[model samples]
Target: MESALLLAPKLVSNPSREFRSNVRQFQSSFCGKSIAIVEFTRTDAYTNHKSISKITSLFSLGKKKVKTIKRETVIPDPDYRIPIVLLGFAGGLVYGDNLLAAAPVGLLGLLLLFQTTRVKFVFDDEALEVKVGEELDESGENVFVGGKNRWKYSSFVNWELWWPNFPILVYFKETQTKPEGQIHFFPVIFNGKQLYDVMVERAGPSKTSGPN
Candidate 1:
């Protein structure tokens, strides 16, 4: 006898008051009323995680006021048949019921705390499953995938260590230039040196040109 399989699409809920409330609370406390989102540049000839962190420290981290930055990036598929990609930044999923804001914030003390490290990676193709690694552990890396190409988890050492670096309060200019604030996260799938090596190798090469 053959068995029949019932296939149903995964369900996603609408935005919620709880999230809006959190957003309100976040906005009031965080200082994010405008467009956030830092420009995550692939490590340049003169920069590395440490240098980037240094630059970040100078801006929002300076005055000690937090900002809530939200960002959305849409990846277009050349095949049009492939669904357009939508990536919601930290604290966003909560609003849309896609993820719980409470869990992350309770532990990390506001998503903005890990701005450089906070990211919501999204894969829209029905055929794509994000390859989803073996097991997810506790770290600030998963949510952002910062190391792989250019993402949140890419620049963090440990969420704990990265926390203080996030700007508590940030201000945005109407012009929409530069990141005012960001989201934060901890380990979700991969961990430790494995994560580090992946980023470094993909980063191509160190700016230092030396002997063969």
Candidate 2:
């Protein structure tokens, strides 16, 4: 009876040991699967991130950057000589008892003087443009019926600065304004030296020689 009791206890202990071993095996397998799933998720995320970065880099490389050319002021300072001379002439006319002539001359002088304060000449790499005010804003449409305030240097057929020693007037003909070519005349109300220099440089040498 004692031996039988001992044998029964051993049988019960063996089954309990087997069940514990099985539970340990199942836990180890589940833990390994969980680790593998976590590793795969991280690797996939890393791969996707790398791919996105490469695509972004390729797009950046493909896009071309545009170059912007800056416009420069050719006539930085204004010349009031033309307007002052006109006004002086008008005053002389008035003194000479020529009221009829004086009225028009005085009006013209006033207009020119006002223009001298507002008008500006600006030059870009390709063209010459007229601007207004200290801020260099567009001068709007030309006073002439069919004319623009801008002209390309390439389109200039010829240009001249009259009385170079004491520049009073500037004249230029350009095909851009008219295919047949258009003649333009403007008073020298800007820095004559700078104007002549820029014109020679951009539009090529004028037919007439400038100041020595």
Model 2 over residues 1-212: C-alpha lDDT tens digits? 99999888775665223211111111124323311111111113333432111111111222456899765656657889888988999999999999999998899889989999998888888899888998989877788836669999999988999878888888888888789888888888888988888998889999854322
Q: For candidate 2, what is the lDDT?
A: 0.74
Q: How big is the positional error of residue 184 in model 2, measured in Å on the Cα after superposition?
A: 1.0
Estimate the TM-score of every prediction: 0.17, 0.62
Which runs in model 2 stand beyond 4 Å of their true positions?
A: 1-72, 145-147, 208-212
lDDT of 1 by residue, 150-191 (tens): 233232222221112331221111111114433333332222
Candidate 1 residues lying further than 4 Å off, grouped into runs, are 1-178, 203-212
lDDT of 2 at 174: 86
